[model samples]
Target: MSAGGMGPTLDDRGARSLLRTIPVRKGPDLQWAPAEPPRRNAAMPDARTSGPTAGRKRDPLIEPRVFEAAVRVYARAGWGGFTFDAVAREAGVGKPALYRRWSGGEELLVSALHNLDFPTARDCGSVRADLLDYARQWVHWYRHPDRALAGRRISLDSRARPALAALYEEMINRPRTEAAREITRRAVARGELAPAVRSSTLPDLLVGAMSTHWESTPEGSRARLRRTFPAYAETLVDIILAGAQAMPPRP
Candidate 1:
């Protein structure tokens, strides 16, 4: 300013302001520094990156042994005897542990029924095959001693225990009915079944027939029933499918 502007010499502040106006030059040697990664606590493990629990083996949501114990208790003592304390004693776990998983006896029974792994309806490209597969699963379930015993006990007590019956209808029967409905729906969609065919009750009829047959079979003849149930399942499916096909279309 003194030489060019013909003015008084600038103060320290004015000189600093003039320096700020200069553009910075970035050269080949000027590279951005890499940012440092966040540090992790070595003592504490992250649960998300690990399993359900960190630094501990993950536990099952409902243990198989616990489910078996619940079934055993229910089968042995019916609804009245199916208490949390009884189930815990049978399962070899504390009542608190069982409570943590299920709120009450009904919920525990529902979970046990779920653990049976009922077959879901699948698309086998043909209604006949789909029905057979579904029925076959029921045959297997009926033959299993633990599951059959539990189911028989529930069926017997359904009238006396309305709450248990409601739970069973909601959790078990509803899903099974829905699966069977899906098979009929698929058949109608493919033109194999008439749109107005009343096949909604087909699953019930099949299940009722199976249950009656099972109950009527004498204890001494259970082995024979086991051997014959597969063929019976096939015949049952065939008869239902034939009737459904022959049903007149609704007006």
Candidate 2:
């Protein structure tokens, strides 16, 4: 991989790449829609009233509620408190229902995360513009509370759990790997980057810089990052490309 922003890792792009499991606002500042209790049909028993027994009835609304509750539970408590009992309580469904759907918290969390929606990447025909857009989008994504929390938790906690680690590989690692390769390949084909330029390095540098900036910044000061990210992204992209140009071709 090249040294600066060639193949950006999914780990760094977690906030940017996550599918909107919940409804999300479009554009650069993607806001998560508020979670509401799934509407109950007139004939269906109130989940709160029926309590655990409510899981006995087959309702289409139940599944979405369970998935949404799972995300919230995982986002708030992370891997430690992400248990069926907790999720069931949050969803107002029985634990048995969760058990039937997933063998454990890892499976449930993965399923929930996978079920979310993701934004498509823009192909501006210029690698510079593409990478800048990616970096800016990542900044906007970090501003989302649930996604940032979930991404942080996954990055830290996945280290301890094998299943969670696998989930990370699937959700974060694989997708970014593909994206980085495509971006670099396009750059090379366009003669913007040397044919021998490392595919992963440049993207890694770009997103790595962005991720480090976000992590190092205190929460109280993030508004500044949000405001300054466009210029910051441009500078980072230019620096990486310039450095990439100076690098000698490797065998």
Candidate 3:
């Protein structure tokens, strides 16, 4: 308390007393002993790196919504952005559920696209009219940024991702083949054309002519044939009718 009392202030007295009782610590902790270097251990592969995927079968009970969300996610983000964890988070489900249903992203994407039914009914008054309506529906689908961007994305992935390609095939190509068969079948029924016109060829002709594009790939630019499609359908109908009328009458 007093500036220079020889008995010392309480602080000085306490410091001196503590110094006497405290043990001294020794110098620099040099405990590491130098020795010959041991052989380096090889790195272990991660559990995921070696997991089974070659022939893994998906669980049979996948929910439709999960698959749909997965496709939308992948279509917008592509493969790099997709993962079981990401999809589960987006879908409000556990990651394991998605994995159980789909071994990988491709299967989920393909299944989702397959779920989108193309509009191809047989009655638009005539096959020609039906095809035109179908073309209009396709144009509506294409004009939507969601479907266009999705279609473009899936189309690109298809080379390495066969299932996505198969999805496209099922929608675009298969329906064309089937619808053509239907059209030919109708013609036969109505006595409008020869039964021997080859049903298969009818689809080929229609699809080939209607679907011709500037780039000729799913990823390519659609031919500026929107105006031409309906026009061609009408002319095609007229030509087919004329040809049928000129042929010998059906027995």
TM-score of each: 0.70, 0.64, 0.46
Model 3 lDDT tens row, 163-208: 7577667755577557757866776677666676666655555444
**Which parts of model 1 have CA positions greater than 4 angstroms off?**
1-58, 155-166
Which structure is stronger by TM-score: 1 or 2?
1
Clashes of each: 0, 16, 0
Q: Model 2 misses residue 239 by how many Å?
A: 2.5
State the lDDT at 180 in candidate 3: 53
Question: Judged by TM-score, which candidate is best?
Answer: 1
Worst 10 residues of 2 by lDDT: 113-122
Could you give me the TM-score of model 3 versus the true structure? 0.46
Regarding lDDT, does 2 or 3 come out ahead? Answer: 2
lDDT of each model, Cα atoms only? 0.80, 0.76, 0.59
lDDT of 2 by residue, 152-208 (tens): 677788888898889767876677567766778888889888877878887789878
RMSD of each: 13.0, 28.1, 18.1
